[model samples]
Target: MLSSVLRSLQSLTTHNNEHQECATPGSSTARDPRKQVLMSSTTFSGAGPSVGKRLNIDGDIPDPSHQLPALPSNLPPPNATYEHSTPPQIPKYINAYSLFLAGSIEMGAAITWQRHMAQFLHHLPLTICNPRRGHWDPDSRPQPSDANFRTQVEWELEALSNASVICFFFDVNTKSPVTMMELGLWAHSGKVIVCCGEGFWKGGNVKLVCERYGIPCVNDFAELVVEAKRMLKQKGLDAVTDEEIQRDEEWAKGIVARKARKEA
Candidate 1:
């Protein structure tokens, strides 16, 4: 009778362990899918069934504070601009000639002119030389001895010299002392073009100067861009900039990768 009772107790224990291993279908434990381990029993060696990869609810690793957004499928990878990227190519003038916007800050009137250039002549994006981009201006400009000032001056000088066509804007509200200086420097070169508004403080002087030098002058800003496009047709896409060349390289790489994928 003792042996038979022992067998009955063993059977009941086995059933209890099985019930604990797999939860009931409608139990609270079954509500979360992540809660299910489904691992098998271990041997005496302390080894058990292999564990699967760790679950990633969002499939992205995050920093302590924030997670970066995943890149969208449809967009092309971003291109790195080589504007200031070095080793600087030897500055041989290639198809780099453009409508060099050589002028003073003049309350950022160049921005409005740039938009018009984009709208009217989408293909030809004029090269702009805005010296004030990286630094702030004082009421008094930086001295010629300053290294940064010298670098900007060199860049502007190069732009003015190499440009096939240049369109200058002398805004009414801005006396643009620098703009007037540049006008004299480039006026006789025949590549210079000018736009001085009606109310410009020195409009008469600018117009008279342009007339004397035979530099094309217009009263309207939009006319300046229109004239640039007309001149660009005569002057084909000159040597492209370093940034444009880098973008082309990136595009070529993408094409090659796509072709390789297809072959694979």
Candidate 2:
């Protein structure tokens, strides 16, 4: 999409340059002011009721009613030939190394994982996709049949499939039944990094599964952070910050609760 947009832009620029060149001394288009009009802000006809009002210059003046088409530019130089750069080392520009955060919510293990992501891997270009990190509700446990739950599951699955790696951290608190189920689902795929701390109910099974699948498994939080960073670096992506992922009120509440639990 970016490449196409760039190509269109290049074509348009070349066209405009030629148009400008044509109007150098004397040409039929020299008298045309439309060619000279560089679109800077929302242009109003100033013909009717809204004539007195100042049109907004922000963000191309959103025209919701009609779709704006790309303006045609003048033709390029007759001798100018197309040039392509040598193939990029990487396929394309990935915003970040997307690592889907999976596993444990007990005692806010997910929050701990998020913090580690910030403390250690924060400098790296990566995005941790953990739905439970901020959306956990203390008042009510949502059922699997709930629309939100189902939708979150769908989104997580999609992120898992698309992510560079699946980082699973098992807290010693809950059984992490859903996490285990997800482990099974993604077991065959080689995109998992399992971390099962001591006393986790399913630690043994998780390890065994990791061994069977030849996936990298760790037992410490620091180890998990290191491994996740290694994986992201190998993908050759730039480090992105938390500013990209906006935490909502619910997520903020979860963070507060996690902090309070730690303080207690």
Candidate 3:
């Protein structure tokens, strides 16, 4: 195990060196500052408010309480989307909720349903943990030795841990083996809501697991958003601070009103 970890660290060091050289000043391949810092060193020892304890180069890669507030009717909720390689911290705000998007992302070929879910839930106090790489190459198949691929996996795992809710979708067009594995990991955590389309190759197996675990399972994308939002709102109400409720009393009331009406 130690030997394998050393090898992965070495691989990460080499990848970082290459990235550094290519991103030199005046180079056409230069990346932005955040990207530079994120890929800075194999050690990942950078110190910053957002940067936390070092995750291994192998790239394996929060709580609150309060009365809550009423979400103002007709008011949009505060939200943000943290893409891959970005800092894992959700926006530091009262009543914030985090949702990790897990599911089919077959090299970006699978439907861009993530965007749809983000848009649909944008009106809530939520942060979307989206793992889709903004500049990924579809043809570059991921391998164990690829540091970038490992880093992406690390980010997703970290995001999943930070999430108050995780939404998984199985698109019928692709075989998402990784997503299936993720479901296995989080099925009993009570933080997952799955949407497996009927036409998916593993729909039956997925449904069986959901049933076994008593997970909230839906059959389509729309329902996934609906259920995920419901879970987020419930969590938000429980975790929002007294200050947040006072500051956004109207909005908080709106949230409570909406929930009451739904229950009614």
Tens digits of per-residue lDDT for model 1 on 8-58?
Answer: 334544653584467876776445322222111000011111124211111
Query: What is the full ranking by TM-score, best candidate first?
Result: 3, 2, 1
Q: How accurate is candidate 2 locally (lDDT)?
A: 0.47
Tens digits of lDDT, candidate 2, 119-162? 34434444555544232222222346555444545666667776
lDDT of 3 by residue, 1-264 (tens): 223323443564566568756676655433222233222111222112231332222120100111122222664453443222233333343334678888765434355566656665665556677775444422222454766566666777877888889999876765565677678878889899988866676677788888888889976454565577567656764443454344444543455466458659
Off by over 4 Å in 3: 1-95, 137-141, 238-264
For candidate 2, which ten residues in a row score worst on lDDT?
39-48
Q: What are the Cα lDDT values of the candidates?
A: 0.46, 0.47, 0.56
TM-score of 1: 0.49
Error of 2 at 125 (Å): 2.1
TM-scores for all predictions: 0.49, 0.49, 0.56
Off by over 4 Å in 1: 1-96, 107-122, 125-141, 236-264
Instruction: State the displacement of the C-alpha of residue 224, model 2, in Å, after optimal TM-score superposition.
Output: 0.8
Supply every candidate's count of residue pairs whose N, Cα or C atoms clash at under 3 angstroms.
5, 5, 9
Which candidate do you rate higher for lDDT, 2 or 3?
3
lDDT of 1 at 31: 53
Query: Cα deviation in Å at residue 119, candidate 3?
Result: 0.4
